[model samples]
Target: MVLNDRIGSARFVTKTNATTLDPFKATEQGYLGVIVNGAPQFETLVEKVHNLRSVFDVRNLRKLSEVVIIYGYQDDPEYMYDAAISHHADGIIYAGTGAGSVSVRSEAGIRKAEEAGIIVIRSSRTGNGVVPVDKGLPGLVADSLNPAKARILLMTALTQTKNPELIQHYFRTY
Candidate 1:
C-alpha cells in the first residue's frame, strides 16, 4: 500500500511554480512513450489516453507530465526496469517477460521497490498472457490489464485507492 518507490523520478520533472498551464507547455514534457506490446494500435485509443483531462490537468501542477508513444516486440524490449525504479516514478507498469515471469535480478529490484512500498503491477510483457491476479504473489500485485492499458488503469487506480487488495479489486472490476 505504500509507494515507497525509491526512484524519485518526479523530482526530475521541471518546476511548475513559475509557469502557467498551457497545452503547448504541457506537450513539451515529451511523449509518455507508451511501449505497446500488442492490442492493435488504435487512433481512438491513442487520443483517449493522450487527451485525457486529468493528464492535461497535471500540467497545471508544479509536476507537469508528458505523454509519448513507443512500440516493442514480445521477444526483446528496449527499456530497463530499473530506470523505471530509479526514476522514483508514481507507478511502474511492468510488462513481465513471460506469464508475468520476472527475472531474478529484476525481481529483487522490484521487491526492493515494493518493500520500500512502491506500487508494482505485474503485467504480461508477452502481450497475450493473463497476469496471475488471484494467485497472491507475496511481493506484488497483478496488472489486471495488458501493459498498454495497465498504465492508464493503474494511474486512475492510484487516485482512488492504494491498498493492495483494493487495487486488486479495482483490477477485477474497474
Candidate 2:
C-alpha cells in the first residue's frame, strides 16, 4: 500500500483455520504483527513512529511568502510578469506545457521576472517527470513537482532565502 494513503480496506473471516492479528495488542506492545492461516508469521515493525512533529520541523515557519502559478500558452504572460515585477510576488511557478517547454512570449516574460529578482521555478503541466535544467532557461527546474505544488514549496523556500541556488536545493531535497 502507498504510505500517503489515508484509508485502507480489509476482509475478516471466521473459521477454524482463520488467523487473527489484534491491532490493540500491537499498540500495547508498540509493535505490529501479521499472521496467516492460524500461524504466527511476520513480526517486523519500526520501533519509533515517524512524524512531521510541528510546523517548525519544516522550513520558514515564521513567515509565508507569496507565490503565483502561471501557465505557458498562446496568451501573453503579462499577468505573471506584472505579479512579479509590479505587485512584488516572491516566487513564480511557470507551468509550461510538454516537458516544461515554455512559449517564446512566456519565456521572455519569465526572463524579465528573473531580472527583477523574482524566484522562478520551471514546472510542468503534464503532471509527471522532472523538468530538466536548461542553460537557456532563466530559472531553476522544479524537479518532479507539478505547477501547483511547486508554488507551495517555492513560497516556503522564498520565506527562508532569496538565493536562487538555495531555493533550487530546497526543490531537489523537499
Best by lDDT: 2
lDDT of each: 0.47, 0.67
lDDT of 2 by residue, 1-174 (tens): 111121111111111123554221211122233445544443554343324652215543666787888888766556668766798887888988877888787888888998888888998887656789999877898887778778877876766678888888877766
Which residue runs does candidate 1 get wrong by more than 4 Å?
1-82, 134-144
In model 2, the worst 10-residue window by lDDT is 6-15
lDDT of 2: 0.67
Which candidate number maximizes TM-score? Answer: 2
What TM-score does model 2 achieve against the real structure? Answer: 0.66
Model 1 per-residue lDDT tens digits across residues 60-131: 335312111122234433344445546656566656656676655555655666665557777765544357
- Measured with C-alpha atoms, the lDDT of residue 37 in candidate 1 is 53
